[model samples]
Target: MLLPLVWMISASLMPLSEVIKVPPVWFAPDKYSLANYMEVWSRVGFSRYFFNSAFVAVTITILQLLTSAMAGFAFARYDFPGRNVIFLIILATMMIPFQVIMIPLFIMMARLKLVNTIWGLIVPSMVTAFGVFLMRQFMMGVPRPLLEAARIDGASEPYIFARIMLPLCKPALAALGIFAFLGSWDNFLWPLIIINSQKLWTLPIAMSRFTEQYIAQTHLQMAGASIMFVPILVVFLA
Candidate 1:
């Protein structure tokens, strides 16, 4: 598992010749260079892709956390009618693959005038069913007596949620945020389908195109993969 990652970073630093040699040039201390990374960054306008990805990922993470935390609190505490059925419906949607609904989602985005725009990549991804489910499960573990005591003291529902519930949900919120950020950052197929303009491409889409445009350039491909992997690795480690 780690070997592939190690090899990718190593090959990314090597020249084209060293990367493609028989048995592979596992290490090339003397020949390592940043030429491939430089070319990838400048030649392909990857800076734009990086910014678009970061913006979309951060926005989605914030929105997902807010929505999930709210929905989870409601599901865990409230006694609204048909709550179980509604929660079931939301969970059921998760079972259906995105591929099954991509066409309809695309048409809806087109109608909303969001296609080929940054929001096209963002709006559809604002809420994730998995996030809601994960948060709901975590919130269920929270004590009911504490919430009741807050209400008995005349604490408003909003205050109790924002001030009390959220403060206690730090671990769940962190996990959900990481999941949302990674999903948004690494997304490719939906962006490829919606973003027609070159300026709207994300890292995954740009990397796909880069692979095709530089098919024979193994060193460049490794360099691009390393660039893409670093963020997820850091977030995962942290």
Candidate 2:
């Protein structure tokens, strides 16, 4: 993994001409330049892809977190008719693979006129079953007496959740945020299926096209790969 990261960065810094050299040059022969990056940026609209990815990832993470946390809270803290059955049904959906429903989901999106739109990508992912499960499990560990005490003190459910339970779930929130962001950032197949327009393409789609456009040009491919992962690598490291 680290090898790829180092090789990509080094190859990207090298001029495109040197990238295809048989000896596989480690860096620019003499003067390393950022021309490859600039070229890749101009060709792929790096900034636009970055913004679209950031928007989708951040929005999905936030919305999923809120929905998951709230749903988890309800499942853990309250008892209602068929609550367990409903929770089990939701968990069962997690067992059903995306492949099983991909075609139907596509048809639904087409019917909704969401195909080729940002919402097409985002709406489907804003509430993941895994996210709900993660939050539910985490919330279950929270003490019931504490919530009861808060209720006895006249705190509303929303107040108790926001002020008390959320503060305690920071680690879970962080983990989910990272997972959700990374998932959205690296997603490829769904976007490929949904979007036909070049202007709305995300980083992964752009990278796929980059490879097709420059097939066997390993250096350019590496540069494109580098462009794709640099931001994510920084985020992971941080």
Clashes of each: 0, 0
- lDDT for each residue of candidate 1 in 1-238, tens digit (9 for 90 to 100): 7999999999999999888899878998999889888988888688788888889999999999999999999998899999999999999999899999999999999999999999988899888889889989998999999999999999999999999999999999999988999999999899999999988889999999999998999999999999888889988998
lDDT of each: 0.92, 0.84
What are the runs in model 1 whose C-alpha is more than 4 Å off? none
Residue pairs in clash, model 1 = none
lDDT of 2 by residue, 1-238 (tens): 5776777888777776776778877766584777777777776577788777778877888888888889988888889999999999999998898889889999999999999999999989988878888988998899889999999999998999999999999988888888888888899889899998887898899887778878866766776788778767766776
Candidate 2 least-lDDT 10 residues: 24-33
Judge candidate 2 against the unseen true structure and give its global Cα lDDT, from 0 to 1.
0.84
Top model by lDDT, which number?
1
Best by TM-score: 1
Worst 10 residues of 1 by lDDT: 39-48
